[model samples]
Target: MFTDGRLLSDPGPILARVRHRGSPRAFVFAGVQRVPVVSEEVGQALKTLAPGDVQLFPVSVEDVDERFFIVNVVRVVDCIDEAGSTGVQHYAEDDPFPERAGEFRWISGLRILPEKTEGARAFMLKRFKHPIIVAEEVKEALERIGNLGVMFKRVTGNPGA
Candidate 1:
């Protein structure tokens, strides 16, 4: 949902205010094709994409119709502070190098279209901190999926929406 001019800034506050829960472990969104990774992985990947590029982060779930899901693309800025390092160590018990400083902060989280909702594209643009740019490859992938008529439906009452 990032617009055309707001790249290279932080999208943290907007993400924190979102009411949705993080994606559940069992309902990984990998099959969506348009969205290729888990939220954490997506955050990591954003580090390489050009700032302001729009990218969709798909979340998959069962018991919902196939036409609704969340989709949004906004600029991501990673801040790897000491607290982030602590979080990583806590999550990954077998820290590869516990003695060394852990200096890796991920995309943290991002904003996307809520499930069963429309206007996400516009919403992200308006709320995002920076101008959004859609990566050429990502845009092409979306187009390919659109041509195939692959759509998603939102699931109400789902814990991880």
Candidate 2:
């Protein structure tokens, strides 16, 4: 794992589709840049973001074997805690959603269905698809994160050897 964010827990199975609905007001301000979180702690921290809370985390990926990697977790307290915290929009101190903070369990699944990220640009994914097919650079990036050499060798089969 890259040493900065202190995210990325031990590899685990993750659901393929996740739902992290973006706030409409944020869309109005920042377009489509949603900071991806990997670990539950980071997800908890990120939940405390309003609009201007510019934090970063690693992008999640679906590896070649159908296992999910780098899932971001979310909860209600963090969202409620973030109110009026100088984000894309300002919420009054009344913070209309305090009641929502206890309504559900923490949600941590997979990709936000149809969300995009900077790392996703390194590969190709069509809508209605299940697997994330890798491009050249993306394959290299995967190698950096962990060994996928078995998959690579199975594909290449000593093409140059």
- Alpha-carbon local distance difference test for all models: 0.32, 0.27
lDDT of 1 at 5: 26
- Expressed as tens digits, the lDDT of each residue in 77-106 for candidate 2 is 111222221222322345575533433222
Candidate 1 wrongly placed segments (more than 4 Å): 1-38, 51-131, 139-161
The candidate that wins on lDDT is 1
**CA deviation > 4 Å runs, candidate 2:** 1-124, 148-161
Determine the backbone clash count of candidate 1.
19
User: Against the true structure, what is every candidate's RMSD?
Assistant: 16.4, 18.7
Worst 10 residues of 2 by lDDT: 22-31
TM-score of 2: 0.20
Cα lDDT of model 1 by residue, 35-101, tens digit: 3222433333343443334444333344432322233444343311323222232223356645433
